[model samples]
Target: MALAADFRHRYVTPEASLYAGEPTRCEELAELLRHILQMVDRNTPFRHGAYREIYEALHGFLHAGIGGSAKDGLVWGVKDFWAVWESICLVHVVNQNPGDILTCDMEHLPVLLSAPERRRAWLKQRALLFARNGIRRRPDLVLAGGDDIKVVDFKYYAYMRQQRRTAEADEIDKIEKDYLSMEAYGLLLQNHFLRNADARANRLSLEFWLPGAKAARQPSRQQPPWDPPLSVVHLPAEDLLRGYVALYPHLRLMR
Candidate 1:
């Protein structure tokens, strides 16, 4: 029995500064996300009921036995360890990666399992090139999925909307102006993760799942008119990237 039980350092070092810096650095991205979330929050307000139910159910389960589940109070902000681990596990099962899976929270994977370790290895192998300059915007999920690396943004919305200019209001071309609202997130992920990393396959996948709807639009029944398909306009990845780059310049003035 090699169990040493002598206590040494007691208090946990509070890292308030790191969290405090998150807001100012990611103001622009947060603002854009807030804009989109506002639409879901206000117009389709009733849809949030389902999200609340899920959050409550998960919270109850975690509090009942699982201890490490951090509670933030806000329905949307609740960080359940099980949810995160399940997501990682699902990806691993589908991808069939040999590397172990790991997370920041140690309690989430206390068994020292091979899968968790493989997951962590995959994450570390990514050529993560993040710019820590003017304003910092860290990607929500940064990890390597075997051969190719993935930078993902976990978006939780009640409903997705398509905004058009009203008859009396200004003529705003939201769809044309932006290809994909998520493109900015893609660019941000690239700037932070892929750029200056190892010589690996760099691909960014923006994972968004709404409370009432799937993250992206479903595939169409008929064939498209264009090569890549016009329905892709629905995805609008380029639009999102453009928006992010355009907003990047303004980040310096945000403070």
Candidate 2:
């Protein structure tokens, strides 16, 4: 009770309050945040890290407002959404802790990261120190723990939709490209990263997370036809579509 009263007194007070211009809770909270940031001392190392985490939390909160509409603060265009998928996958890791391998029977695919490791932090689009054709390789998601560096590339492969059409030469070409890219990611990390020198290729575990039919059987080992210790994780199309609808409810229900 005292705390609540103190908060109201500090933040909600207005001596000559104008009835026509009362401050919204959102604006008031933002003002409070500005005050907090101004007061925070960034000189101390430990406190600086903690302050940084708090800033990220605030940024995330403001990135999307209370209402889930267009007017609700910052939003992204849906041109290329693999980045969004990468974020969602990271959430699954942070929330569910899928460990190194996913269970055969699971709604969400397991993440290559472990619980303690996931809690530390998951990175996004960190540029690898390798480049081909003057373009540096930046994987979608990355996590490092001890001798292991786990990397995941989210594929908006659209297999569920693509299955309707017959495979053609171009499709084969695309698949080959994707596999080769995954292989390159493993190699790039091994070259610069010195932890697992003996088994350079095996040091980093890379996987392409793709959407697939529930009827499709989960392979005990890696998903197939390609060889290179590459892995494939099949997330349910129904759930993925459901997630899309949750984010944008305009599209008709998936047939």
| Cα RMSDs, all models | 20.0, 16.6
Alpha-carbon local distance difference test for all models: 0.36, 0.48
Backbone clashes for every candidate come to 23, 0
**Model 1, stretches more than 4 Å misplaced?**
1-66, 69-127, 134-149, 155-158, 161-185, 192-203, 210-255
Clash count (model 1, backbone only): 23
Ten contiguous residues minimizing lDDT sum, candidate 1: 225-234
For candidate 2, lDDT tens digit of each residue in 80-121? 344445545544554444443221111122222234343333
Model 1 C-alpha lDDT versus the unseen true structure: 0.36
List the lowest-lDDT window of 10 residues for candidate 2. Answer: 101-110
lDDT of 1 by residue, 66-102 (tens): 3435332111122343243333333332334333221
